[model samples]
Target: MTYRAAIVGTGGIAASHIAALRGRSDVTAAAAIDVADDRVHEFARNWEIPRTFTSLTDALASEDIDVIHLCTPPATHLPLAREALAGGVHVLLEKPPALSLAEHHELISAVDSSTATASVIFQHRFGSGATALRQLASTGKLGKPTVTTCDTQWYRDDAYYAVPWHGTWAAEGGGPTMGHGIHQFDLMLSVLGRWEQVSSMTARRTRPVETEDISAAVVRFASGALATVVNSVVSPRQESRLRFDFEFATIELVHLYGYDDSAWTFTPAPGHEELAETWGDLLTGRPSGHAAQFDDYYRALAAGRVPEVSARNALHTLEFAAAIYASAAQNRAVSCTELTSSSAVWRSMNPGRTARAAASA
Candidate 1:
């Protein structure tokens, strides 16, 4: 049976998914849903979507959708996703699955209790570059990763924050770390498995937003490797870069937004130089993005298995970000184990007035 999907929240991101799903034989663009009438209808007319509704309730009520693509703001992800699963519809949420780990757990509960499945848009993980790295790591070709560096430095102007939800912790969750750097760092975590602890510092350097525009962290992975993570929106020249220092060679990827094989470079250490040929053969031509992940998502739905980028997988990245914020706020190193249901930061990501402050008062 061909699967049907409804595009929710007709924003800039929704256009990417619509374009990706245009000619897929396994999934159909069943309808479009958004609270904004003009934007939703315009999206529908442009994409030639057969149906459109201004509310999820109305679209679900009509029984015209099997999947929901949530491109709405971060604050609304949990409720809308839970509602969709409750109605027996699958959900594909955009990045930053939830505002906090606590909210993410609730969505996990929703998926657990319902027959429907849900996934997050950690699209970078689905790329050829990611696949090649995973193989190298597993095969011991990359050896033990000694250090990893992830830097997401891009400029967002004052006008970018004009959107009511763009900069607020309550809406966007956090700053560059939670919003922009997430994709790059999520890929970092994908390459290096679990994180042991994180020491971080966040500051609102220049952007007149509620959240920090500049932040840095030192993360220790479970594999005894160290990683330095930097997220910033103050850079004049932007780049998304990640580097892994393994025993035999150092692998680095440099690109903005997306990358293919050409964006990656490998340098071998002394006496172990033949790995360059092996690495070149492993890289793929297709750059990673929404389209790459959509291919995997549709394939999973076609089979009986749950999709890639599952809620649990997405939680690792979310928990990692939470650790950074919690560590920065509490002025100490934070372990993954500390971010539990009872944790203060789990309830909110705001640094100025944390959940701890509210609970203590």
Candidate 2:
């Protein structure tokens, strides 16, 4: 059965969504929705989408859209997803699924009540290398992750933030930590499992934006593995890197944006040379990107199961991001359990700013 899909928020990312949908045999890119009528029509024309609407409501009302891909800003994710889910349409949201844990919870509640499912786009986890790493780590083949480092060091100049929603806490969420490095760290979390605590620091070094231009964190996982995470938009030399050191082998991935099997390297420790063959066999599939994720999502729908990176599954990564902010703000290590409904970080990732605003008022 071919599912009809509507692409919402026809910005630059919508093109990726459309392309992914087009690549799928069981899905059709039926409609494009955006607030700007001209832009939406242009996007539809460029992508050969048959329908266009100025809003998701109009698209839902007119087109028989089975799923809606929300490629909008961070602040708009929850409401748009709620609307699509309410109409019994599956929702595939862009990264940083919601602005805060509070908003993410609302999305979770909406998904719980509706027949439809919602997934966040953490495309890195769908890669063959990441999948192989996850399987190896889970099956004790990697011999326990000991030390790790995840870094997203990409350069985005001042002009990049000149876009209205590019670097604001209210719109894009929180600079590189929320918008950029999330892909790498989310993939890290996927392979490493639950994170226990986070201690972090954030700074607005160069960019004249409301959010931090860089963030660094020390994360401890439940398995007693220690990891360092760095997110930056100010680096001149750009790279996305993740390295995992296990007792039996050392695995590393170095790439920007997306990764194929070539981006990964596995070094087996002495007496474990056979693990190289296992890694080679496991990492022989598609690259990490929207197309791979969309393929898996459709398969989940066909199997009557929740898709990978579902709203619930994605919450851990979102909470980990929030914990970084909370730790930076409070100047202490933060536990995941601390970000409850009553916590200020739950309402806004930048709780320090919220507190200062309240004090002045």
Candidate 3:
């Protein structure tokens, strides 16, 4: 059975979701929603979407929609998702799910209280190269992970931040660290295992916006691995890549232009012969990354089982994000538990506060 889907935001990122959905075999794009009426018509016309609504409430009222893909800005996700879940629609939400872990919890609670299946989009988990690397890391053959690093060196000009809510704390949440760099950050955590602590630094390198345009962090994992992240929108050319150096092997996945199919290189450590055999299994079809995640979510929904990428699992990523911010602010290492606990600092740093204050000023 084909899942009927509706997109709640029709911006540039929404176009990617529409494209991915259009390419999927078991889903159909049934509707599009955006506050701008002209954008709705343009998107629906260009993508062949059947129904268009300016109001999310109206789209949620449609009985045909089984899944709602929320492509709205980070700050707007919680309320819109709450409304959709209340309307009995499964939700595929975008990253940095909300402004804080508190809001993330509220959304998760709402999903648990309803029948809708909810998940965040971490599509990098779907790449063939990502799968091959993750398999090698998971097995003891790769020995133990030593270091992993991710760099998101993409360029965004003045015009890119010209949109009213582009760089502020409240509207967009954070800058490259939370926005552009998060895909690889999630990937790093997946391969290196859970994070035990994080220390970060953020600065405004290029844009005059309210949020920092660049950020970097060093992380220590529970398994004694070390990792670092560098994110910026100031690079002259665009590049996205993740490299892992393990005790027994080194694997790197490089994506040249945005999020298309990527290329990879794997180098086995001296003593690991058996681990190299897994590359055949990875290339043939093991399904451990993004595609595997998507398949797992679909199967669970069909069989009345809980999704593998559950709200709690999604919360871990958010907690890591919060730790990054907290680490930078406090100028010291921050624990994962400290980041997820009830705290007034994150609520005060909502980033959207600047936008709201700007309106009043």
Candidate 4:
């Protein structure tokens, strides 16, 4: 059956969703909704959407939509996600699903009790290099993956933060750490299995907002692997990459600007023929991007199977994020289990408190 999808935001990232949905014969942009009237009209006209709504409540009340894509900012996700789940519409949530761990848990509970499917947008997981890396790691070709590193040195100028909600703690959650760095963090977690503990530090190097513009973290995985993440929004230019080290092999993934079909170097330490063969097997498939992710989501919806990028899957990533921030705030290593179980920490970071800080800062 064809899926009727409605896009809720018309910002820059929403265009990526629109492009991914364009050619799918199983889905169409049934409607568009945004607070900005011009954005709503322009996107609807450009994408050939037949209808547009001024708000999410009005759109969710309509009976035609089968899938709802939440492309709104970080601060606005939880309430809208809960609303869509209540409306019995499948959700394609954008990155940094919520501001804190408790919100992520609450949203997961909402999705679990509802009949709707909820998935987050970690588009990098669909890229060829990343997909290949995950496959090799899963097959034990990496030989007990011991170390992983992620570098997200991207530039966002003063103009980029000109928007009212761009860099504030209340509206945007955190700086590059949560807004941009979360992507590679999610990808790192995807490849290395699961994080057990994290210690992080965030700084306001360039941006004047209350949230940090630069941050770094050291993560320990459940399997005893070490991982490091470097996130920044004032790097002068954009550069993105990841590298993994194992007992018998090493792999390097380097890309810039955005995800594209790219090549990676798989180096065996020595006398590991099986590891080399495993890498060879992984590289045989064609590269994929946003289109592949959407295709997978659509297929899952059709077969009544849970999507791989489901909200529950994303909650782990969100838990890792909250642990990092809490470690930075408390100046100590934080356990993922503790971070996920404590709801008070998340309550402090909610808009109720963060909103006051943003107003004063």
Candidate 5:
């Protein structure tokens, strides 16, 4: 039986969802929905989607869509996901799942009360290399992780932020730290496990936007591993890289967007030369992208289980992003536990600025 999906928000990222659905015989893109009528119609025509709607409400009422792929902006994720969950339809959200941890927790509650499940798009975790890395790390084949680095240094000019929502805290959330680097660092967290603390700094040096164009953070994982993370849209040299230095070996991946096994290098420590052969045997050549993740999601649905990158799993990544913002805004290290609903940063990423403004008034 084929599952039907609706691609909501016919934007740049919606095409990736459409392509993933098209590649799978067990799933099909049945409809397209967007606030703009012309954009929705054009997207449907371009992708040969069967139906189109100007709103999710009309689409949900009119079509038997099994899942809604929300490629909308950060601000719309919570409400759109709630709407989809209300209809008992599964939801696949683009990353930075919700604007804040509070919003994410609310969505989690919505999922708990609904018959359907909600998942965020962190496709990198489904990559074969990432899978191998996680397994090796979990089983201690890589030995204890000591140090790591995750960097997303890509160039996004002023024109990129010219989009009304691109650099705004209200819409896009928090620039590259939340929007762009999330995919890479989410992959990092997937391999490294729970992060305990974060110390960060954000700056808006180049881009003329409300949000910071570049951000840096030092993260401490539960395993006592320390990681330096850098998310930047102002760098001239574009690269997405992650390096894990374990006791036995130093494994690294360097690629701008997506990577296959070739992009990863497993360098064994002096006495552990044989581990390189193990790495070669374990690495699956499958590349990381939407198609791989969609396949896994469908399989989970078939088995009547929650999918990878489920709301609960995504909450950790979102919390990490929030912690970066909170740490930067508050000018101190932020613990994951401090991000409860009562926290000021729970509602806004730059709560310190708001507090300072209020105090001056």
Candidate 6:
């Protein structure tokens, strides 16, 4: 079945979603929606969308949209996702899916009750290098993986945060840990099965943002592999990198934002060079990006199954982020299950209680 897709928000991110959807034969960019009438119409014209709606209410009511690409902010995801699912429409959610675990669980419920499905845009996991690592580890070619790392260091000037929602916990969520590094770290969780605990620290530094501009954490995975995670928007030389140290070989991937085969290196142990050759031969040329993942998501959707980066799968990544905030705020280590609804730290990852402080003022 060909999917009739609609783009729900026409912003900077909408470009990525549109560009990827434009050339797909199995999907049609059926409609475009945005609050700005003039801007949305122009966006639709440029993208060659045959239909446009200024209001989501009107768009959902008028268009028989099979899937909705939610390129809006984190704060809008819960309602947009829920509404789409309730309408039996699948959703292609942008990263951080929700601000908290509670919201994520709700989306899962909506998904369970309907034929529709929802998946986050953790496109980095779709890359050939990452796919290779996951497969190699699963096949025992990488030996028992012991150490993994995710580091995202990029600069975001004050001008970058001038957007009204840029820095707020209620809107943009929690600074770099939530907004910037989640794409890379989500890819980390994709390779490593599960995380057991985390210890983290966060600071606002110089960005003048409500949430932290830098966050550092150490994560212990269920597989006995320990990972170091660092998120920052203050660095000058930007880079996104991940490394895996297995009993037999050390695999490394380094790039900014997205990576291709050119960014990955497979280093072999003296006796395990054969294994390296085997790994290098797989997933070599595929690049990590939105289009690669969308192909997987749409194929699974057409098959009537939960797609890659499904809500249930992405919850673990969200839990890890929440655990980081909880750990950083309390200055202690936190277990994965500690961020349940009953936990005070589950209260939306906003540091310093600035909102609460101002609400009482």
Ranking by lDDT: 2, 5, 1, 6, 4, 3
lDDT for model 3:
0.77
lDDT string for model 3 (158-198, tens) is 99999887887778777887777888888777677789998
| Poorly placed runs, candidate 6 (over 4 Å) | 351-361
- Candidate 6: tens digits of C-alpha lDDT, residues 87-154: 89889899889987778889899999977889999999999888888888889877888888889999
Q: Write the number of the candidate with greater TM-score, choosing between 1 and 2.
A: 2
TM-score of each: 0.97, 0.98, 0.90, 0.93, 0.97, 0.96
Top candidate on lDDT is 2
**Stretches of model 4 off by over 4 angstroms after superposition:** 284-288, 340-344, 348-361
Query: What is candidate 2's lDDT per residue for 1-361, written digit by digit as tens?
Result: 8999888899889888887776677988888899999998899899898888898888899989998999988889999999989989999999989999999999999999999999999999998999999988888987988999999999999889889999898888788999999999999999889999999999999998999999999999999999999999999999999999999999999999999999999999999999999999887678999998988999999898999889999999999999999999999999988989877788788997778777899
Candidates 3 and 4, the one with greater lDDT: 4
- Clashes (backbone N, CA, C under 3 Å), per candidate, total 0, 0, 10, 0, 0, 0
Candidate 6 clashes: the total is 0
Candidate 3 local Cα displacement, residue 37, angstroms: 1.1
Candidate 1 lDDT tens digits, 1-361: 7888999999999999999887888888989999999999999999999898998988999966789999999999999999999988999999899998889999999999889899999888877878888888889877889999999999999999999999898888999989999998999999999999999999998888999898899999999999999999999999999999999999899999888878888899988788888877887777898989998998888786899798987999998888888888889999989888777677887645664476699
Clashing pairs in 4: none
- In model 2, how many backbone clashes occur? 0
**Candidate 2 backbone collisions, by pair:** none
On residues 1-361, what C-alpha lDDT tens digit does candidate 5 reach at each position?
A: 7899999998999988888787688888989999999999999999999899999999999999999999999899999999999989999999889987888999999999999999999999888999989888888888999999999999999888788999998898788999999999999999998999999999999998999999999999999999999999999999999999999999999999899988998999999998888878888788999998998999999889999889998999999999999888878999989988777778777786557756899
Q: Which ten residues in a row have the lowest lDDT in candidate 3?
A: 343-352
Q: What local distance difference test score does each model get?
A: 0.89, 0.92, 0.77, 0.81, 0.91, 0.88
Compute the lDDT of residue 8 as modeled in candidate 4: 92
Q: Which is superior by lDDT, 1 or 5?
A: 5
